[model samples]
Every structure is written in C-alpha cells, then in structure tokens.
Target chain A: MTNCAKPSANCAKRLVNSMSVSNDAKPGVNSYSLRDIDAVLSAFEEGRLTPAQAFSLFREMGPQFEAPPGQGQDAESSNASRLREALNELDSLIGLHSVKRLVREILAFVQIQKKRARQQLATEHLVLHMIFKGNPGTGKTTVARIMGKIFRETGVLERGHLIEVERADLVGEYIGHTAQKTREQIRKALGGILFIDEAYSLARGGEKDFGKEAIDTLVKSMEDYRDRFILILAGYSEEMNYFIQTNPGIRSRFPIHIDFPDYLPDELIQIAELMLKKREYKLDPWARNHLYTILTKHASNLDHNAGNARFVRNIIERAIRRQAVRLVDKENPTREELMLIRREDIGEGL
Target chain B: MRRCIVLGKPNAGKTLFVLHFAEFLHAKEVTIKFQEPVAAPRKGTGVDPEARTGSAACSLDPVSGSDPGAHGRNPGAGFGPSTSEHFKTYKIQDAVRDLTGPRPHTTRCLQSVVLELPAGKGKKTVELIDTSGLTDGIHQDAEIRRAMSQTLSSVRAAHIILHIIDASKAGKKGAVEAMGDVDYQVAAFAQMRGGYCILANKIDLPGARDGVKKIRDEFPGHIVIPISALYKEGFKEVKAFVLREL
Candidate 1:
C-alpha cells in the first residue's frame, strides 16, 4: 500500500486551534472526543491496560487528522518508578511479621474493594482503625510508617506518608487554644497516619486543664476523617487506658488494640548483637551472656525498663570502652579477641 | 456517714490519699458508693424575687425525722452546686432513705457524711473531699484559685484537715524554697480556726526524716506525722488520730 503520510501545514494549524478550543471549553462542557482520549490514556497510565491493549485501543479510535503534540513522557515514568522504589524500601525495613501480615491483609482488602468499585459490584466499605498500645522504643513509629506504605500500595492513599506528634504538639496553655493546635496537627497529618506518643499525658490535670480541648478536637477529627485518616495513640499501658477512659467520646472510636510486649531476655541479647553487628563489632559469647544477665536483672527489678533497647545500647557502649581500655599493644585484635568480653568488661554489679 | 475533704497542692498525693481513704472506709464495713453528677433538664423559670437569699434568714424545718443531723444547719448552703454536691446529696439520701423506706419504726438512724464535717456529731458517716492542691504552680490559675478559695471556705466543715507534703523532696534547696512560697496559702488554711494535721508522705525515701523535722519546725501548733503513702506506712496512726480527734 502506498504511504499516505504527508506534512499538512493547514492540518497543524487546525490541530493547534482544536487544542485551544478544548482547553477553553466551559468547565462542564461535554467534549466527548477529548474526554474519551484522556480517559483511555489515564487508564493506561494507571496500569489498567497493557501496552498492546493501549495500542489496539489507539488504533480503534483512529488517528485524528488534526491532533497536537503532547508533553514529556520521561517525568511521569520516573515518578511511577520512584514510588515503586519507596514502597520496596519500606517493605525491606519493616521486620515484624505479624505487623507485616496485618498491613498486607489491609492492602489486599483495599485492592479487592477497588476492583469491585470498577466492576460496579456490591462491596462493603472497609475501615482500618487501629490502636497501638506498647511501651516506648518497641517500633510503634516504624510500624506506622509501614502502614502508610501498605495504604499506598492498596491505592487507598496516593502518596503514603506519616506524621508523628506528642502531647506538647496538641496541648495548649490557654482555654480554647488547645482545639486549634490539635486541629492544625490533624491538618498536617491529613492524608496519612497521625501518631500521638505519650497520649496519656493529656489526661494529667483535672477538668479545668486545657488538654481536654485537644481530646475533644481529636475525637471530632477522627469522626470527620474516618475514611481517609488513621490515628494511632501510644503510651504506657495504664496511662493509655486512663487516657481512653477519661473522655467517653474517644473510648468508643478506638477499638482495635495491638499490644507490643517487652522483648524477652534472649530477644534483647539478640537485638544487642544486631546493633553491635551494624557497628562492625563482634560480641563474644561471654559478653553476650553478660549483657543478657544484666538485662534480665534490670528487667526483674523494675516494672518498667523491660524491652528498653536504649538500656542495652548504653551497656554496649560501656563494654566497648572497657574492651578498648583493656587491650594492650595488640594492633587490631583478631575477631575472637575482639569478640571476647570478660566479666570485668561488663563492670561490677551490672 | 461523715464527709471530710482532703485539700492539698499538686503532687501533694490528693488522688492517692482519696484512693486510700476510700479503701480504708471500705475496710471499715461501710458501704460506700461514688455518685456521678445528676443529669437534670434545665428549668426555664427564673428564681422568685421574694425567695430568701440570705443564709441566716433561711429557717430550718423542725421536722423530727430519723436523721438527727438533718435539720441542724446547712453549712454548704451558700456555696454553689459543684462536683462535691453529687457526693453530698447522695450521702444524705443514702443515709436517710433506709430509715424512711419500709423500715420506718425500726429506729434506723441515718448518718450522712459530708466533706464539710459539721460541728455537732450524731451518727458519724464520713465523706472525704479531695480538693485540688494549693501549691504555687497551680495557685496562679483563676479556676484553681477559685476552687482553692471555695475549698478553704468549706474547710471549717471538716473535723480534721490532712496537709500532705512530699517528704522525698522536703529538705532540698528547691523544696525548702517552695515551702516559703506556699507559706501564705498554708498559713491561710493553718491559721483558720479549725482542726488540722500534717502528713509528711514519702517516708520510705532517704531524706524524709529531715523533711518531717522541717514541717514540724515551720508549723509548730499543728500535729505533724511522717508517712509513706506508697508503702502504706504510718496509715494506722493517721486512722487512729482521725477516730480519736474527729
């Protein structure tokens, strides 16, 4: 067949005129030709259509004799690739299995609902409201970040992000001021998870306390954004209970409770070793046992201080210093020698 | 039932003291119930202009019921309705209801406890009112100030006042400094023409001995007792003193 391709200057001018006409149309004008093309292109970009399917659809639509040139394609592809990279990074960092399972299940459910929406099938709305109650340094913040990623993966969120706040951020000094501060924090955390650490501190003072205003505002926002936003309140067990019970309004909404128990003695030892390994240091069996013993003793003595990774970190630093001081003229001791930490290195009465 | 108010500053162990007092009263075989605020629809009508507003002008109805203390005098009449009112009205009804309902002729005398312990005593039903602490940090707030003022006005109603101090921080430089700061508020309550007792809490701590001494030296006339609320130390002495004096 003879090629019919030809440079038509009049056609190019008509294409530009058509582009301007489409751009200048009234907001609600039914420009079916341009609208259909845009819809098909968006569907393809969103991965609803494969390249072959898009090509077939493009052919079916037929080439417009007066179509204008489009803008850059590289920027859009790079953005999609960047989002994929972020999700992969998050997936690798979060290690808790149960937390991961919960997040994946939520994401899968959301995807199912999205597919159902496209099919116009009857599907119930899914609401993922969760409360994380645990002691400090137990990966509450990390879990929140993973949840953001999971939401983004499920298409519930366009860009997964997390915002963490404390009692000081929400509370105010004067009456009627705490509500404004709490509302501002909610706005900052609008499209993502809002994490409130030490939330129990909000209930410290009596009725006249301004913290009550923050609580009221938080409860109202939670109701207002039940679909889009997730609020995670965390603190000591007893204090969190008091915080929830202090206001009858808050007690009802937050029902899903996930408790993170203190890490076992062995778990703490393993964690310490992991931390040391990250720093390119090896722990001898004796040193590991010594660290475990100290952690166990401390855990037994105090109701708190359990699963406190910080305590282990401090002990590791002390042990490292002792080892450094005890080593004589040995230049870069062997791995075994470097790993071997004696009782003296742990110090007395640890 | 006798109602007594526990008034102190922040960190003065008011909440802890109230918890212990409730436990103590429960151990004494007294059936204690916490009364929540009564929800009543607001009345649209205004008070009658002819209604008596003066305290002295108000007359006590001379109806001789089983409650011997009912018509004596309403010490809390002038003060407006507060959270304490729930406890007060509940105690009154709880005390007198058994006497009037079904067991009328059984000589079942009802003893109501008010945080403001009235001067005269019949059947003693004690109510403990845990007032907000009157410390320097909290004294600046208008609401706290008003609550403290209202609490002080009703202080005379209690047969005994327990002044709780933080023994652990007693003799430190900041502790000693804060003592002088709260001296005015303390003097206002201590100088009141009413019975008062001092409690040096946190005795389990190392410096509690010196703290007790400091309090004893500062407020000489009032009775000072060293205690540890957390450890439940010297609580028996406190209970004995309350029973003996009030």
Candidate 2:
C-alpha cells in the first residue's frame, strides 16, 4: 500500500511554514524531488541539460529536505543533493556572468510556461529551438544547462535536463545508420534540451556524407516533437551560419541565434580568481598580478583563443601543480601554504 | 545503367537535394545504393557491410563493369558468383559502411530511379551520381585538390548538372558579387559547356523572389527555376525540367 500520510491540515501548514523559512534562509536553494534530480542528471548525461541548470535546481532544493531525527531520510537526501550541486556548480567555478544571465533568461522562460500550463493557458511563447554561435569554450554548454533549470521551474519540463552531444554522436558511419543514431540521441533528450556542440561538423562533408542523414532525421524529429524537446546547435559563428544554411530544414526550425562573445582580459582574471576560490585557496596580490600578465600575453598571441574561462583555469591549475612540485614537501601541503601561487610557479615566458 | 551526376557549391543544398531525391525514389519503390564506404573497423575483427556486398566496388572497376542497369539486376554478371553470393545477404549496415568510407578518389556510384515522362510515357530507371561540391579557390591541401579535380572530371559525362543558388541570399550585395563570380566559372567549364539548369533554392524565405529575379536578370538566356529545397517546393517543376533537358 502507498505510504498514506493523511492530508492533514496541520502537516500542510507546517510544510508551508518550513518552505517559507527555507526560501527566506537560502533563496538560492531549490526544492525538487528525487525523481526531478534523476531527470536532471539523465538530461546532462544525454546532452539535454546544461551544468548550470542542474546546479541552479540543486541549489534551490538544498535546504528544503532537512534531516528529520531518527528517520535519517533527510540527511541522506541532503548529502546526495549537496554532492550533485557541487559538481554542477563546478562548471561555473570560472565565472562568466553574461553567460549565466543568458542561462537565467532561459530558465525564466521555462518557469513562465509552467505557470501558464498550471492555469490551463496554452503555452504559445515558449522557445523550442535555439542556436549558440561562438568560438570554443565560450560557455555554450553552461547556458544550455541554465535553460534546463528555467524549463523545470516554469513547469514546461517535468524534470529540467540538458544533454550535450557532438557530430560524432549523432552521425553514424553509414547512410541509414546515421538516421538511427541521431534518433537515439533525440530519444535520450526527450522532454528536455539537446545541445549539439561543434554542430557545424555535421555539415563538413559532400553529398554522400552521413552527417546529412543525421540532419534529415533531426529536422523531422524537431517538427514531430516541437513541444517536447529543444535543440541548441553550437559552434564557431561563421561555420555555424554556413552549416544552418546548408540544410533548408535546419534554417527554418532554428531561427533564434545567440552569440557568445569572447571574454576580455579582466573577465579572464575574475574567472581565474573564481577557480582559485573553488579550491578554497587564495592568490597572493603579487602572484595574482603576475598570473594576469601571463594571461594577457597568451590571449593576444593565440588567434582562436576566446580569452575563455577554461583557459585561465587551466593556467591556474598548471601554476598550482608547479607550486606543489617545488614545495619543500610535495604531499600534504596545507591550504595556507599552497595559497600563495608565485610568479615562478607560473614558469618563465608562459 | 545511365549515370546522372548532381554537382554544386558548398551550402547550396547539394546534400539535402540528394537525400530528398533518395526519399522520392524510395517512395516510388525503387532500389537505391550510395557510393562512399565507411572506414575500416578499429581492431579489424568484424566484417563491415561493404566487405559483404560487392556494392563497394569502385565506379571505374573493370571487374564490376560500368553498366549498373544490367549488373544491378544480375549482380553475378559483373563481379562473379562469389561476389554476387555475398551481396545476397546485404543489409543496411553495408550501405552505411560504403557511404562513410574515405575514398581519396572522388568517384561516386549512386543508384536511384529517374521518373521520366517523355511525351505520354511513364517513369523509367536511371542511376544518379551525387558528387562533392567544387571549390574554386586554390586548396591548401593537395590531396583534397586532387580529389576535387577527379570529381570534376567525371561531371563532364553527366546527363544533367544542377547548379543550386541560395535564393534568399542572392539579392544581398555579397551574394550578388558571388553569383557573378560563380556564373563566370560555371559557364566557362567545358564539362558544363552544353548548358546547365539553375536551381534558385530556399525560395521559402522572404527575399527569395528578389534573389531569383536578380539571377534571371543577370543571366537572361539561362534556364533558372525557383525552389524551396527544405519544403520540397517546386520539386515537380525541377523534375519536369530535368526530364525535358535530359
């Protein structure tokens, strides 16, 4: 028999009061069921949910399920939730607020649609297709995740999820094979978002290319499941534009294009700091200045470099690794001892 | 069988055109085969479809023969009993393996039905060869340039050439300039010396008419047809045009 906790008015009142307190105490915390969390994780695995959306949803649910004494239910659930949230938020460990804002807007739209559905109003304004055109590491995946959250919050999606995939995943080795593979990916991303990174790679061939089969399948599915799924095609701006125009079906379905601009040097530094903080470490003032100078030099040298947060994070990691190796004792260095990443740590001419 | 090749520039709906054409043939209950083959297995343990079926034979293979019309019906006549027997158990896996193979040689051996209406006659079977788009500028890679050259060499023998233009982009300043440049190159090609039909694709877009008009104005004597390749619009008109010209 189902666990029948009577719909007691007192219990409902207590629930409401607890919810209010949770909301007031940690506005960032999300309140979601275990099923919802599973859906979000599945979406991420399937490339339908972005990391940001998963993070935002988990954040909202963090404080809601407090441990009840002896039952041990709340503690286990809370611990699992915190672990998932930490991993999801790790993507944002390198801050790019512009990308975050874009993700929030997507989530907001999902929430609005959910409200309409509850009121029995038709959802006419929901965006089912989006295009992310930018250089690599511009946080396109991050934005896709946040959009998933917005969808969950708005009630457009039962469980907001984001799945990230690539051309190789969708395009098969053969003509008929590509269609089936592409279909499977779509099935995996059902009722959620599917992000196709380097989407233009699907168009990088001639008449007999298997990528064409994937494109044909994607177009048909997009039309058939317009309400249930959203597709985000991301790649280098110029190539992506050409890729869309290559197929008439793609051009019609994906009308909205979101451009992700490369980060400036200052933005890169801020991202570097965020990465350091995530590890519970702080940079010495001089070390920070030295790191910033190295980033500025490298950013100017590389043509395809987007001044991406990932690049800064990677450089910081390298510096930390160098510092660790040079330390008096390589193993078991305390946080304070490792806190000051030096100029020498970054290495010469890097 | 007679081979008809489809050739054009990048982003000119070449792949979409071929896919839709294949679908159209499939709807008519015609057997179609693609030319390109998939790469070999990583560990080399299992047999791919291309190895099973004799269909992966090169277009110029002397043993397989060039006449697909006769060989398509009687597979044994060209490639011998052993090769023909293997093809009997042909699956879609083989078709995909063939389609995905990286052939440095730019030969494509596509087979599809050609619905032709000559006066009061019904549709007939005709093989279609869909080749890679021609890149006009100097290729940085010598291998790619050679492959493209080989593909272009085969186009001279094609019964028809489908020159697709982006109708929506035709009226823009850049597109207008590009159209002029493309027209000169295409018109100058000895392979397309006889003449070619211009397919003004993407007519579903707002500025398609203006683009088509610009092309028509620029090349008054050339045969130009407007179409929305995505929506399958003007496909009948295109089919009729191909039938008459071929």
Q: Of the candidates shown, which would achieve the greatest TM-score relative to the real structure?
A: 1
TM-score of chain A, all candidates: 0.69, 0.68
Which residue segments of model 1 deviate by more than 4 Å?
A1-97, A325-343, A348-350, B1-246
TM-score of each: 0.44, 0.43
Q: What is model 1's DockQ versus the real complex?
A: 0.00
What's the iRMSD of model 2?
30.8
Cα error of candidate 1 at position B64, Å? 94
Cα RMSDs, all models: 35.8, 29.5
lDDT of each: 0.54, 0.56
Flag regions of model 2 displaced more than 4 Å: A1-98, A113-125, A329-335, A348-350, B1-246
